[model samples]
Target: MTDYKLTEYSHKAGCGCKIAPADLEKILSQRSGTSFKELLVGNNSNDDAAVWDLGTGMSVINTVDFFMPIVNDAYDFGRIASANAISDIYAMGGKPIFANALLGWPMETLPLELAGKVMDGARKICEDAGIPIAGGHSIDSKEPLFGLTVTGLVRTENLKRNNTPEIGDVLILTKQLGTGILGTAIKRKAAKEEHAKAAIDSMCKLNSVGAALSQITEVHALTDVTGFGLLGHLMELCSNQVSAEIVWSQVPSFPFLDEYLALNIMPDNTTRNWNSHELKVDGLIDLKAFQVLNDPQTSGGLLISVAPSKVNEVMALLNADGLNHAAIIGAILPKQSKTVLIK
Candidate 1:
């Protein structure tokens, strides 16, 4: 064939390869029990990134995300992968200062030139975020993989956590859903260029708005959607006292996604996610709708919780940051029988 397809080398599709949430929970249940005073955020609550206080007004944020190829193009794969990784830094209300390349390639099966293209893609995105790819580790592997480990800085007061949303906070999603579905379609070579571009463009777009949202006092919590999908990540925002409601009409979704859903094209992670945490969701209206909600997002949007009075302010920022499609999907409320209900 005309050159090799990068997607053909990987068995998994981008963030869809993430471990099932329930299994992940069990794996994380036990910890080393070591503690550090400077550690402001740890793995205890599944927050976006680890924050280390420097004994000043600011904190250092660290997060690394890597995944298998989600697209057929090597450069796009790198761009999307890197964007997905750096997103974690922004999810924590911090500005990325630097990044490191994490690459895994099967040298025997793929050309080294493709891997170089992947690196170029990641470097460009890091530059877009005003950061440098200082260094990282690489290994030979069976599948093609690429991403970044990003470090950022945020004022201690502006640091956001996924589990800290308040009951009265309104929820905002800064991007549309359905990358997982489109990713599956692309992998199968069944996707049109237009549809594929939508997914890739969304994935390549940075959630840099997260850094700006940090300065607002009304914004209560923040996290970027990835393998877990919107529902899974939203569940992380819930506590015994906090729950959420999602209005489907207000939730943004990618174009042509319904067509693919009609074709029954979706990542395996969709069902894995729903089965892992379906008990926590109520108001089941549509199965397909739920699929989109449960779809694993590679470089997805930022899920924001803000005080009701400041929704306008947040909307203004999102619009200014070229995220005009971002919408107020629902609200955070006191815990009900289920943590999240879709209407």
Candidate 2:
């Protein structure tokens, strides 16, 4: 049975319901920008968070992420949403110390206790992260929305960015993909109970283990794969100096991917992700293989680039901590016009 008495709504759910890619592109193209440098990190590349240099060893990483209900249960939705927001801080190799709530509630429709459960869920997760939910603002809205604005601290030298993948660095993903697809399936009432549970577990899982890897000093770059999917995140890592080759068979995913594909439960973001790639994806072993690359993830795992020699050691550490999903999905290739090829 569902947990909330949510009314019929007009808009789509979560940030996943964002404007279509082509329309959004046209809008962003007309916007002018400067003084972005003051922001240590911003949404320029659709990254998970923003950062600002605070001078000395201190820097403030600020990110505000909010979305509608991804799960049927109000408390679980809140927990997953909070975990998704806090992940941005961990992605930057920083520890979150504080967070403020961002909410859009329709109290006239949904029960207040349901909202209380949301706060309780957020509070529990914050307690685990050792961060306080200081305070926040809310407004009545047509649809439900909730998330957090988090603040974290990282040393200058330890700040990790998505754009810094070094040539020859191996790509490591800490969590499996296909959550967005499965979530969509849940909304459509086509998802199996076990599959939906697995996807929810992945989305709610924290990236703190990956963040702790910064102590190794050899992990080159770090970023969480969320709305952008794996391919989009890889493109953000690629530049004139770096190219990549990801093994399709080697990429980890939820066991139900083939089953879900058979059901045609794919989300709208999947095609949008594939269309974002101008360069052709070569060595396409299977169409479904390529399609998985565009499967939008929610609160997905950290995609890390590390020195080849250090790969085994890092994997050993992650595995020792029971992070078996942390595996080398691909390796950085020599500079090429096409940033990625799936084999």
Candidate 3:
């Protein structure tokens, strides 16, 4: 077996490599397009996945996501990437039926055996999700990358959106934050074993709970926090109808995140994330808090907005599903010039 560190081969870890929000928007803005009435959800909304109405009371959800390794283990990297890709479907309140593997390899650098292990790891996750890898395409590339293009089905009425939060809605986050910070620590060999394990465990978790939450009409808006971080994703929920007020102390985060932050260990994407939308943030009370909020997350968690009356029910469902760290982090308020207000 070849002993290789996957993270060493990649310039950026996981979603940390995503194009900065500002740059992406600029690229997307240049394209003028004809609208399709059947396209329920598309780029205009910055939604997790594109939904096409099937016109039979069901909709087809499609999304593709791929990224470079964030961990040293080939198997773990595969699992995380697969989970991250499939999360978009769950975020749209759909059940994934099948997926097509997406792989890129540095043929001269990494051994094929390690790549096979990556596929095996992704296969295990597909099995757990009760889906099959129907087909895929591969390419020779500079770095080893893996993910999936998932297809899902959802009742039209059950489809959740990232831009539908209403005033008085409560925000519930399904997992703790700080994966980006921990990932940076891992690359620098500065993280404790327990902290690394925590990050990997969180990334490996599926966000299928978002689909389940769709059954409750009170779930006004749903999105999985990924490369953009919690605040970035929350801003999507706020849209134009309302703004968010987050109680900084109530947000769920890794136990030793402060230790990593204190050492100045942070992802490169953190600054890009803040700069993209900092103009719309209010009450920037703590610098560390601001950085943590902007830290890119890989396969992080679901950020849900639910009607205030259903907060208890939503929390109960999350806890019953074993999301113990899930928390009611904030609430929606009347639209303000600022997108988010942190206390």
Worst 10 contiguous positions by lDDT, candidate 2: 1-10
Clashing pairs in 3: none
Better lDDT candidate (1, 2): 1
Query: 1-343, model 2: which lDDT tens digit per residue?
Result: 3455332342444446555445666778765578665577765555557788877767888888888877777777788889999998999888999999988888787877878888888998888788999999899987888899999888867888887877889999988888877877777777788887888777777778755776667788888888767887888777436788999888988877888788787778778777877464566557677667888778888898999888888888778766678778998888776788877
Candidate 1 per-residue lDDT, tens place, 248-328, comes to: 888999868878888889999999999988998998678777889999999999999999999999999999989867999
lDDT of 3 by residue, 64-106 (tens): 9999998989999989999999999999999999999999999
Model 2: how far is 154 from its true place, Å?
0.3
Angstrom error at residue 101, model 3: 0.7
Model 1: weakest 10-residue lDDT segment is 1-10
Global lDDT of each model? 0.91, 0.78, 0.91
Q: Estimate each model's TM-score.
A: 0.98, 0.92, 0.98
Cα TM-score of candidate 3: 0.98
Off by over 4 Å in 2: 1-11, 19-26, 30-38, 43-46, 278-280
**Cα deviation of 250, candidate 2, in Å:** 0.6
* Model 2 residue 104 distance off true place after TM-score fit, in angstroms: 1.0
